[model samples]
Target: MTIWHRSARFHYRFATNRPVAPATGVVVDLSLNIVGDFVSHGGFRNYNPDITRPTPHLIHSGHGTMAFGGRTWDVGPGDVFVFFPGLPVEYADDPQRPWRYRWIGLEGPLALPALASIGLTPSQPLGRIGDPATVDRLLAEALSGTVERAFPPTRHIAMAWQLVAAIAAKPPAVDVDTVVHQLATGDPAAPPSITAISRRHRIAPSTVYRRATATLGIAPKAYQLERRFDLAQRLLAGRTLPVRDVAAQCGFNDANYFARAFRRRYGVAPSQWRSGQI
Candidate 1:
C-alpha cells in the first residue's frame, strides 16, 4: 500500500520476504526511510477502526515531530511508537526538518501481547531506546540485504523481538545485583517463566540465567524452585493443610511430583521432613 507522499524525498522498500503467511509471530515488512522536505500531504495515516488490519505495526523515529493521536509528539532519536491492530493512527515527519525512521510490521497471536509486555500500547505508544546508537545499528542490520537474504521469517521475528527488548532494557548504570534480586523474587504469587522474565527485564534468557547463577549461585529455574520449596516448608510447618494443598500453595499442581522433588532435595519425603525425621 502506498501510504507516503509522492515527493516525500524518502527511500521506502520492503525486505526479500515481503509477504509471508499468517504465522504466529513474523515480520511482514521491514522498511527504512530518510524523510526530507516532506510534501504538504505526504504525512502517513492508517486508520483501521474496524479491526481490519491482520497485523500490528511500529515506528521508530530517528528525529522529528509528527502529529499523532490528536497531538504533536516531538519524536527525537530513539523514540519508538506502537500501532496495535485495528487502531487508527497518523504520523508524519515535520516538514520543516524531516526525519529518518524505520517501520516494522508484525503479525501473530502473540504480537499484541509481546508489545504490551514491553510496556507499549496504542494509548501509550511512545518509548525510548536505552542506547540510540545500538538501535541505529540494529536498524541498519535489519535493513541490510545480507540479513534479508540469509535469515528466514523466524529470524526476522527474533531480530524484531531483540530490537524491542533493547529499547525496553534498563539503563546501563543500573546495578546487576538489583536486577538479579528483582527477577529472582519479583512476584511470589505468580512465578514468571523464563521467557516472561526475559521479556519483563528486557534481557535475553541466557543473560537471565547467567546473572542469576553469578549472583545467587543458582540458575533461575533452580532459584525459583528453591523459593517454592522454602514456601512449601513454611506452610507444612505452620499449617495443618493437606500435602496436596501445600503443594498447590507452592505452585505445584502435582502432589506426587512435589513429594519426589522434596525427597530429592531434603533426603526424605515432605511428610518426613516436616515431622523432623530427616
Candidate 2:
C-alpha cells in the first residue's frame, strides 16, 4: 500500500485508541491521538495558517470566502475548493449570512495519489464538487470506521483509502493562491507592519499589505491588534490576570497605553470592567 494510505490507517487507529488511567501508585503514559466528529453552528471567521494543507478532502462542509492569488471567491453550500501545500489562504464567515457545517480532522500522509487521480493537485487552488449523494456516502463510510468503536486498525486504514478514492472520482474546481501572505497580523492588540508580516510568511511585503486592506478593509497590523485586545477583554472579565500583566500579555509595551486603548474600544478601563463584571 502507498504511504498516504498507511498514514490514513495510522491516524484512524491513533484517534480511536482508548485511554486508560494508571492504577494506584502507578503512572500510565500513552501518546494517544484523539479524533472526533462534530457539527458546528456559525461560520468559520479566521485565516488558519497552521495545519491547513493542500490535501484532498481537507474541507468537510461549510460556506465562507477563500482568498487566493489576489482573488476572493464566495463559498456556500454545494461549494468545495481544494488547495496545494505551501499556498497562503484565508477564509472568513459571511457577515450577512453565516454558515453551519459538519467537520472532521484527520492526520496522516497516505491517500494523495488516489486523490490526485480525481484532480486534487498540489498545484491547484480551488475545486468545486456539487454532488450531494456522493458526498453523503463518502462521509458515511468515514463515520462507519469512527463509530464502530472496536473496528480493526486495518479497517480504518482501508476506509481512508476508500474515502480518497470516492473524493477523487468527484468533479470540482481547485482554487490556487496567487501570492502567499502573512499568517497573523490582525488581532485585537496591534496590527504589525506589512513588511514585518510578509517577512515572517516569506511572501512579498506588498502582497500582505494589499490583501489586508482590500479584502479585510484594515491593515494587517491593525487586525492583529484587535485580536490581542479581544483576548485581553476576555481575560479581564474572567479576572484571571492583573491589569498591568494583562496589558503586557496583550502586546502593549506600556500599561498606560493599554489602558487608553482599552477605554477607547470598550468605553471603560480594564480595571473598571473587571470590577463591574465581579
Task: Highest TM-score: give the candidate number.
Answer: 1
Tens-digit per-residue lDDT, 1-278, candidate 1: 22333444554544433434347664444322111122233344334444333232333433344444575555544566555555555555644334555655554555666777777776677665655566667656765643336454455555656666776776665454666777788555346565544543457677767877988887777788788888889888975888898887887778999999999988998888778823
- Candidate 2 lands at a TM-score of 0.40
TM-score of each: 0.44, 0.40
Q: For residues 208-235, what per-residue lDDT tens digits would candidate 2 score against the true structure?
A: 5666567656765566776787788888
Question: Candidate 2, which segments miss by more than 4 Å at Cα?
Answer: 1-40, 52-62, 68-71, 83-85, 103-110, 144-150, 170-278
Question: Could you tell me the TM-score of candidate 1?
Answer: 0.44
CA lDDT, candidate 1, residue 25: 65
Best by lDDT: 1
**What is the C-alpha local distance difference test score of each model?**
0.58, 0.51
- In candidate 2, clashing pairs total 37
